[model samples]
Target: MKELNFFKCKQVIENNNIHIWLINLEIYKKEINNLKAILNSDELSKSEAFYYRSDQERFIVGRAILRIVLSYYLDILPKDIVFYYNHYGKPYILTNTIDSLEFNITHSNEMLAIAIANRSVGIDIEYMYCGRNLEEYMESLFTTYLQKDLRMNTSEEKQKILLRLWTVLESYVKATGKGIRYPLSTDIRNIVNQHTKNLINSNFEISIDTCFLFKKIEIKDYICTCCILEPLDKFIIFRDEFILELPYYFEKIVR
Candidate 1:
């Protein structure tokens, strides 16, 4: 997999653009104390509620990293950021200080991905080589989708196609704030299948109606996908590397 470089400074988000942070949680282990301290009471309590120590640590680091990242953007203290969740359990910033700051988070195996944008955004990252029998597992989960989308591929190719489809479905539902509740089989079959066919291009991006746009990203050994609730031409996307050190070292922009 291509590892994202973590520098020493914080990143700034621009208007009409999406900024993605690819964080490796392992690097934040030593800063557990600092990160934990930055979590608000509710967040801290949620972290403590995790049954496993590792889970608790991941939650703390993830939430804390979110706070620190948002702080850099909003220019507020990390501990001051408040969050509210929608009915589908999508978290949103609750403060009045920043307007239209929307984001989504997804983590897998030690890698955490965050998408920040002015409009609604969703991201999903999955370990491509996870030990699970993807062929069998995906067949069971996405039987109808596979039948419609992967009619021509070999069994091996089908697995790769299936993973891409899964990420697309996941990120789409998440971006719409419906989560998995949106019946994958009935609700989005037409739009999903169309995007699946479009993924044949090396760089594929399409708007499902005027409300949402879906795109697949090429990250080694990982199926990373993103959805933005706007037409593709309306916004720009910036992929920023993670910074491990707890704050301060703003340098030149990567652009």
Candidate 2:
């Protein structure tokens, strides 16, 4: 795995026409209080900014990490980057300068990931063990074909396969920005089959090529997946290599 260069802060590829940067949120908060300073403002207080659980905090931290990465990439102050929400409530940049910079982000366990391209993109991550009833949930959440696939596997292997399929489905949903309103029982194997056969769904007319990008990483006991809209050839994966040193401010509040 190639390590992303956070210190260099900018990556340029003329031939590929892609730029990517990664920020480890743990390191980010410790190295700079920029995100906290921005969120502390009275304006953002009107928004849902606090979560009662650590999982929610991790989500916010992942978003903050992306903001910091983009700030460095654009050479703009973090506070100056304007954000607005879509109808589905996904946050997106509001500047013309960002028109060409499509991005998506996901977090699982302690790691945050962001993918960028010059076109539309979406990403998703889920903890391998979310402490839920996997068998029951799959029966209700997946289509008949997907359920059949799961049933063919052993108990332990089924759990791992479930996470992998979950990431792929979640990525598709995120990419569509439809959230969970879309029917969970909808045929997913159909989509996967289309991808395999190079066929298009006539109703949606979505090209198999435009449908999904999937990658899975096993981190400790967790499985993390990243999905993007761009062609697979356009991606450059980077795992953060730097050690994180905690700042007293975060430690004080967290403790």
TM-score of each: 0.80, 0.69
Q: Write the per-residue lDDT of candidate 1 for residues 65-112, one digit (tens) a residue.
A: 887777767767777778888998899886566666888999877778
Off by over 4 Å in 1: 1-12, 132-156, 232-242, 246-255
The C-alpha lDDT values of all candidates are 0.70, 0.52
Off by over 4 Å in 2: 1-8, 13-34, 40-60, 140-148, 185-189, 192-211, 217-220, 241-255
Q: lDDT score of model 2?
A: 0.52
What CA RMSD would candidate 2 show?
8.6
TM-score of 2: 0.69
> How many residue pairs clash in model 1?
0
> Which candidate leads the pack in lDDT?
1
Error of 2 at 177 (Å): 2.3
Single out the weakest 10-residue window by summed lDDT for candidate 1. 1-10
